[model samples]
Target: MTEQKQETKCITLKGSAVLLKEYLLYGINSILYQRGIYPPETFEPAEQFGLCILMSTDPKIKNFFDNVLGQIQEWLIQRIVEKVTLVILNVNTKEVLEKWDFKVDYETVSSNGNADDNGDGKFIEVGSKDTKTIQKEIREVIRQITGTVSFLPLLDCLCSFDILTYTKPECDIPKDWDETDPVFIANSQEVKLRSFSTSIHKMDTIVSYRNT
Candidate 1:
């Protein structure tokens, strides 16, 4: 009889608190989906959507981002939930709270590598973070982690403290949701604006999830 050895699972993102702080904000503004919208097979360059990201100097906002990012990373690599590509940030409290303008496109679209002109080559307000650089960086990061596994398309959406996730035709189950305990969030949509911390660090993990 041959004895079998069990392989230990690696915690790549947990040890480092801000798992994706160093990453470029490409996926933040893009969504992904398979070519046929089915499963297992997708097209090249992938189907994409727009998204945004924002943060404030508020302690609660800081805590929220940390918790959300950490949980998502745990699911992405550990649980292999592949969905979402781009994200957008909305630091302007008034705009988000009062107006609730969550749309991703400002004017037009373009095919050029520049996501800033956004494939339109036209002048626009609030452009993306330059797709040329961010896309390459994203692919490199994914390759490092996923190796050669296929991932679903993600349509980047407005990044807020609210419950945002990547999904498919079915809204019930997110395309890349974690299989862990239910995450109870209270007053998640409400947020306070602030500046980026000195640096993304481990000391910034969120302990409380619900209304605290």
Candidate 2:
């Protein structure tokens, strides 16, 4: 009998960015679906990161996230972004109801010089972490997002959502991206979710809702 060997899957800086982007995009969709932000029919289940994730299917919404996450991935590679937030607001009153924040820590990669932008303006691979571990962490985060409805107050009004990115003050802003103030909920209750690190980047998640 021949012995079987197991192969280790490694994560790179670029890979970490990709993973984080997917987490943001899919994670938001999961929240929206679980929280009734949109019609349940607007989303469909898709397997990702070894989990059955709900993905937005509306073309307009899908295109919007593509542009948003694409720019985020670029910034992630440059290590200039500090955090990304998802703000859900009441349509009529224009009041913030919920906020989902994903905080990024680049210190690990920065200390190793892996976050520096190459002359070619691309992320260079520096180190790797086991892919299975990363996915396990992501799965837990998604699970938490789905479970949030148990405690979050019912959103009684029509709601809309916006994406906000926090970056270095001196970072060049793209023409398509606009500057905005942070949207916060009043008398908010916050729940910290599971965090995942790819050795190059670490992401911490928190969800805040209006305590009404």
User: Highest TM-score among the candidates is held by which one?
Assistant: 2
- Candidate 2, 137: how far from true, in Å? 0.7
TM-score for candidate 1, please give it: 0.25
In candidate 2, position 102 carries an lDDT of 98
Give the range of the ten consecutive residues with the poorest summed lDDT in model 1: 97-106
Query: Candidate 2, clashing residue pairs?
Result: none
Kindly report which residue stretches of model 1 are placed more than 4 angstroms away from their true locations once superposed: 1-55, 85-163, 167-212
Return the top candidate by lDDT.
2
lDDT by residue (tens digit), candidate 2, 1-212? 12221124335677788989988988999988988889999889999978898888999899999999999999998889999999999899998889999999984643333344556644556545677788889999899888888888999889999999999877888898889987877799998988888888899999998777
List clash counts for every candidate, in order.
34, 0
Assess each prediction's global lDDT (C-alpha) against the native: 0.28, 0.84
RMSD of each: 21.2, 4.0
TM-scores of the candidates in the order shown: 0.25, 0.88
Per-residue alpha-carbon lDDT of candidate 1 for residues 1-212, written as tens digits (9 for 90 to 100):
12221112111222222223333122221111211112223222332212222223345644655665555555432323323222222345312211111111112222223233246654222222333333344344333223211332231333242334343232345455453322333443322111111121111111121122
